[model samples]
Target: MNARTPRLEEVASLAGVSTATVSRFLNNPAMVAQQTAQRVQAAIVETGYLPNLNAGALASNRSRLIAALVPDIAQSIFNDTMEAMIEQLSADGNSVVMSLTGPDNRRLEAQIDAALSRRVDAIILTGIVSDLETRKRLKSQSATVIETWGLPEDPIDVAVGFSHAAVGREMARFLHGRGYRRPHLVVPRSGRSQARASSFAEHWMADGGEQPSILEVNIPSHFGQGRLAFRGLTDLEHRPDVVVCGSDWIAQGLLVEAQAAGVRVPDQLAVTGFGNLRLAGDMRPTITSVDIDGARIASEVHRILRARAAGEVLPSSLVDVGFRIIARESA
Candidate 1:
């Protein structure tokens, strides 16, 4: 006298169709005849059968899943791009699974393995894969791979981002043009910031400028670290006339510390940061920053993914979103 759970067979029996026909209706209603699909839908409603998506995926060879691996979700620098990508993917009926692997290549590889095990259709990775083993494993996999932040000359698959090297050179040029010599660089200990810092140093030297003092803080650039970096720069024999921070959070911190120390901005010291974060404009003596359009990066990512999904060959695998140096009161 107990009610039993309904099965696909029961739904198929009620719909007066074979199990294959019912499955076609459930997985892709458009593939089935309209009248037949309606009959299967009515049977599904009557029998209260829940289609197992895993089973459906096995049959159709699609999980409808996309995995996105970011370094840190707490950083607002990546939030805009993440949010925009998620919104667009959701609208297209794809589920995004986000995993934070920090900047550790081993951890990122593990996450990639897990995503591949789950049979994800695509993967969005932040920055280039520097680890050879990880890159090899990724290349061996069949999933569609996309590396963001900036398109590399040779990408794993497809890449969408601005050039960190270009950004660094631009920062150096911008400060040099403003008559700010004796520049100092503050960056996180690891990750793409290193590339920016290196490029900045190279450009500074090429311009016949003396070697700038580069301060490497702990991983994950933050306001507190910015303060520490500023203090460290102050300890140098000859203090820098201008400080270029890797991100706005750090630049803003430097500004706050400068104000507290009675140091006048732009007059006594100049400051600039990358990312052009939202708070950049909100800060007093608004921050000078290099702006990369996160929304546009996300849009391009979506477009490339859509094209790949449709089995269309892309003319180019790399897309350069470019960067902008916004001159503000601070520099």
Candidate 2:
């Protein structure tokens, strides 16, 4: 015969506390006195009591569950933000469920539906929802929707991000200031990367520089693609004097390939990259890159959720944390 499943009442009895007190402690430990909470925790462990979160959610009308959707987990750029957000949410007694939406709008919509069916309190998106129907459904839902990585002109509920176009334009100006005239951009075909590439090209031309060349690589750009991009650029009759990459991974690949080909960095070919990842500074001639504060974005998301939970209205729905150019040896 199987042992009976432990009960909440049994835990309360063992802890010398009422069932209501046990329930309060389970829902929010901060509500109970420290000593009492410790006793309740000890009793819970002894009885192996597991609270039914579904029942608690029904009674409280809040799931304390958050769903986070990202385009690609293989891209390490999202790691910092995700780690910080998960840490903050966990501290608040909330659990996070993550899903990869990829490039398909239908897949994204289906994931949202699944999260809603579970009665999640909030939905966090790595990027703005571009699909009209999906946006409408999210706007209609009671869940607090937050978009990160890029600021949308019309957010569903809240947005925390910087301007991709601004980053591109600033990079172009920075390169121009360093006297790099013949520049080439190696970027992924993704939407955000394309946005930056377009802005960079426009800004470069407007600032009296020649029309910059562009090479569109596959999405989720890798180091190999960067090396391939370098070869392609070098094969051209008019080789570029400088190369700007969409990511640090690509930049690192290019740097390694250039070194193998006996090309002096900066002196012969200047290089720059986006996302000031650790490798950017650690690599041999260090890469100049764009810096986005992933932690700040996560903190803003947590702040908005906390404020909403308290029934407080924020002064603004959009929070632009901004980006900066970290000039290093490569540029």
Candidate 3:
């Protein structure tokens, strides 16, 4: 014979609370006193009680779940933001379901459908939603939609990110201020990188500099791609004085290759990179890169979610958590 499942009434009896109070606490702990909530939680653990999420969601219209969609999690660029977001959501008695959309975002729609079917309370995306039908569905749903990493002119609900084009323009000015005229770019063939590269080239030309050379590499960039990029640029008749890279891994690889080839960084060829990752500082010569504050972005996301839960309307739907250039030895 098998043991019977614990009942909600049994939990209420153990916690010395009414069945209605137990139900309310289970649905939203914040609605009950902290001391009472603690007692209920203890009783739940002691009784091995599992709340029926589907039934609770139907009653409260909230699943206490957030779905996070990212293009790639292997890269360190998104690590900090994700870690902070998960911590915050977990503290609020919410669970996070993450889906890797891959580099091409081909799995985005499917992931969204699955998340919606589960009645998630919120959906967080790493980039802007581009699909017309997906955007419309997200907007119509009760779930709060938040887009991160890039600021779109028209967000589905809310946006928290900096401008990629601004980052590119700032890098161009930084290189120009350092007196590097012949600059070359090595970037991954992604939308964000392409935006930065385009802005950098346009800014460089507008500032009376010659047209910079560009080399597009594959996504999920690694140090090997950077080394190959360096070799390719060196083989050109007009060697660039500086190389701007889309990622720190690529920049580090190029720096290593330059050292092996008897070329001095910042003296023979300066290098700059995006995503101010830890490796950028630990390298032989520190890399100059763009730094985006992932923690602040996460905090803003949590704040917005809390406000929405309280039935508060924000004054603005867009939040621009800006970026800065970390000036290091390489540049």
Give a tens-digit lDDT track for model 1, residues 179-260. Answer: 9889988987666788899999999889988899888877677888778877787589889999989889999999999998
Q: Pick the candidate with the highest lDDT.
A: 3
> Candidate 3, residues 39-105: lDDT per residue as tens digits?
9999999999998988877887788899999988876589889999999877777889989888889
lDDT of 2 by residue, 145-177 (tens): 999999889999899998899999999999999
Residue-pair clashes per prediction, in order, are 1, 0, 0
TM-score for candidate 2, please give it.
Answer: 0.92
Candidates 1 and 2 compared by TM-score, better number: 2
Indicate whether candidate 2 or candidate 3 has the larger lDDT.
3
Candidate 3 yields a Cα-based lDDT of 0.91
Residue 221 local lDDT, model 1 = 77
Q: Superposing every Cα of model 2 onto the true structure, what RMSD results?
A: 2.1
Q: Name the lDDT value of residue 286 in candidate 1.
A: 100
